[model samples]
Target: MTNAMWTHGVEWLTAATPDPRAGERAWLPGDGTVLMEAGRHWDLVSVPRQLGLLTLDILWYDPARTPGPTLVDSAAHRVGFLVPPDPAGDWSGEGVRHASRGAWVAVPPPHRTARSLEWIVPPDACTALHPPVTLRLALREAYETLAVLAPVC
Candidate 1:
């Protein structure tokens, strides 16, 4: 989506910030990205960049399973998927980092899609954060797909 099209999605993401107005001023224009805390509105499922991208492709291609907002940090080689809060901290995907409480994530304004950090799928008003099980299964699928594709000795 174009930067102009993401205005509403940007607002939805910014509302998660500790200081919504400050986040707007800092990242919305020329300032850079902002950090929003995890576990309040939702938690995070942090995945390796490549695998996450694979999973993203899988999810996006399937019209029945459009995931929630996803953020990618190319420099860090990390991708984070937003999921509903895990009050029990029971998410146990093989390699996923489920950030519940006391964790934060860097979120880029959607206008900066060309930047190191940007949205893979910008959030809208209608959807809920990804279900942990769905994200976990997709991640596992990505990993297995990669394993099969690798050149073997």
Candidate 2:
């Protein structure tokens, strides 16, 4: 079975971190890491898992204050591996579990590892982050968004 085509929207804000002023945020598609200003210090967010063509974890920085309605700026960073379904595997309703429109699921990786922490994502779930449009355009948009929101240093 072929992997379904899908995409997800970028996250605008990340969960609170240990430091109240600093956090990590994503500015581009396929970006494995990001740095953001938290007051006078810079914080880093790294990809914990290998990135795949289809799946990614949402990570972004949320500032304590902003001038306008935008509380969070820039595209969210993601970390995860892709696991498109095997063409020979069954895709019917035999063992398919009901998932939300954009939920992530843990699945066996294409290659086995001690971690065994791969994820399978539905096409619709990634619509915002990885849209049906060309990746170049999507990445450009993400970068522009980041430029506008990222602080000047």
Candidate 3:
């Protein structure tokens, strides 16, 4: 990856995990690990809940492709992974699971990790969900912000 690509990668991480002052909240456990496949990037985040845990995933894909939304079902509470537009591929469905506390689930094949922890985003605080169209733009903005803030970028 070029310097620019590395910058974008850093930005992607920062955009996914910002300070509480920047509206970044601890929605999940285990922090998160980023995945890059096809042409887009994904953050498998763990969010905790009373009943169970939730994985609040976010994807950044090209807007031109306009991919469809993906639905995920977990054992505890609701698990959702937003599928961003990408020509590469879709990382949704069958990937959702419980991430509450110390329990760790095996990471399915085609994914990088052998196993990972899961969690949920606190439902009450996450109200800034934009429409798909707007989210695409926000994704871009966050990427840019990350590029500017990242040290290695």
Candidate 4:
């Protein structure tokens, strides 16, 4: 069976900040900003934003599955956005695998969870990273694709 687009009920979300030293700060984007179809959920895996030529990686929770309180790491899955490096190039299964290298953000589960790995983009690592503009466009397109894949009704 084809993958069913998830549209979960979201309550709150925290966005990335412009401050570099602040690392990650939690700020609720407010209630009801996210709307997914029944049995489906929206998880903000990563938000690609720039800060002084450096891109920041932000993680978000799906509104539909977020319980009344803090959702445990075990209960959460890292959502991902896949973009083709070459638009005209073949994007078959192999291409998808090759492009998935450092292109993803590693979010680990909690200690009570599996104690998975945790990785973040270092501030000095932007030099080796791709251009900010290109990454931004790719991320935007990925998000749009996610929205389309999600079932509205």
Candidate 5:
């Protein structure tokens, strides 16, 4: 199947501030937002306005029979996949893998029920990572495509 286009509006959760010790490693939220644009496939997105232009790309993964959604950020060099905990035992798959740091970061799932998952990559990282696209026009085209594909309820 051909790739699908999508647009999502995101807001910064924390104000951008300078870090005293780390030079400029300020924590600004809503970097690149990842969403499931298709069945079992996810998209890493960097919206416009924060940066000069918008950018997006699909994360490559090996298709599995029971694959949960996977998220990837080329800029961050991070890849994470959700693995539901087994009712009788602990989850088996790796949680978070930091490519550059050369380590596997184990992230425990929240105790509460998880309806969805979100991964935010830094906007600057995204800009540095992916090429730009005309987001407004893409969003409009995506809307039209969805309207055509929507099922009758």
Candidate 6:
């Protein structure tokens, strides 16, 4: 992507925060990351990194379409998939959970990996949020691919 694309991607990430201006301000100073609220512009579906990576593999192989922005915190061993807020209702089950509404997540710049906060699937497009239904289907498929519905987190 071009510089414009990178800028737009960062814009996309910051705009979703609870305070967009502050998010922008933080980015301007090259801050490592900005804390953004979930369940407004988007909701975060948190899962174990192992399963989340499998889910991403499933999404990429779909041939139809891949999932959207995914935030990874290696320090936390977690991956947070950004999707429309609570679209499928309480996602917490087994190895899955979600942060909605007031919950905050550290959002990194699209083109940079700040510490353990980075994007496995960086936001590029204007509407980078994933479709909830597709994400659920992929999660199910990833579990099936593992050959066991076991908890990873």
lDDT of 1 at 110: 67
Tens-place lDDT per residue, model 1, 10-97, is 6777778777789878764663877788887888888888888998887776687778889887888988889888867665555668
In model 1, what are the clashing residue pairs, if there are any?
none
TM-score of 4: 0.24
For residues 1-153, could you state the per-residue lDDT of candidate 5 as single tens digits?
111111111111111112222211221222322222211112222222212111122221223222222334344444444222212222121221112112222211111111232333322111222211333233344444546777989
In order, candidate lDDTs are 0.77, 0.24, 0.30, 0.25, 0.25, 0.80
Worst 10 residues of 3 by lDDT: 47-56
Residue-level lDDT tens digits of model 4 in 25-139: 1112221111111111111222222221121221222233211111212223322222223323332221121223223232221111224222232111111223324444444
What is the per-residue lDDT of model 6 for residues 17-65, given as tens digits with 9 covering 90 to 100? 7677787677665547888888778888999988899988888886766
Q: Write the per-residue lDDT of candidate 3 for residues 73-109, one digit (tens) a residue.
A: 2443333333332333322223223222232222211
Error of 1 at 70 (Å): 1.1
Backbone N/Cα/C clashes per model? 0, 16, 11, 10, 1, 0
After superposition, the stretches of candidate 6 with alpha carbons farther than 4 Å from their true spots are 148-153
- Against the true structure, what is each candidate's TM-score? 0.84, 0.23, 0.23, 0.24, 0.24, 0.86
- Tell me how far the alpha carbon of residue 83 in candidate 3 is from the true structure, in angstroms, after superposition: 4.2
Q: Write the per-residue lDDT of candidate 2 for residues 1-153, one digit (tens) a residue.
A: 133221121222222123322322222323222231221211111121222121121122214311110111112223322122222322122112222223323222111111323223322222222221232232334445546777899
Best by TM-score: 6
Top model number, lDDT: 6
Q: After superposition, how far is residue 15 of candidate 6 from its true place, in Å?
A: 1.5
RMSD of each: 2.4, 20.0, 17.9, 18.2, 18.3, 3.1
TM-score of 5: 0.24
> If ranked by lDDT, best first, what sequence of candidates would result?
6, 1, 3, 5, 4, 2
Model 3, which residues run further than 4 Å from truth? Answer: 1-80, 83-115, 122-130
**Angstrom error at residue 84, model 3:** 8.8
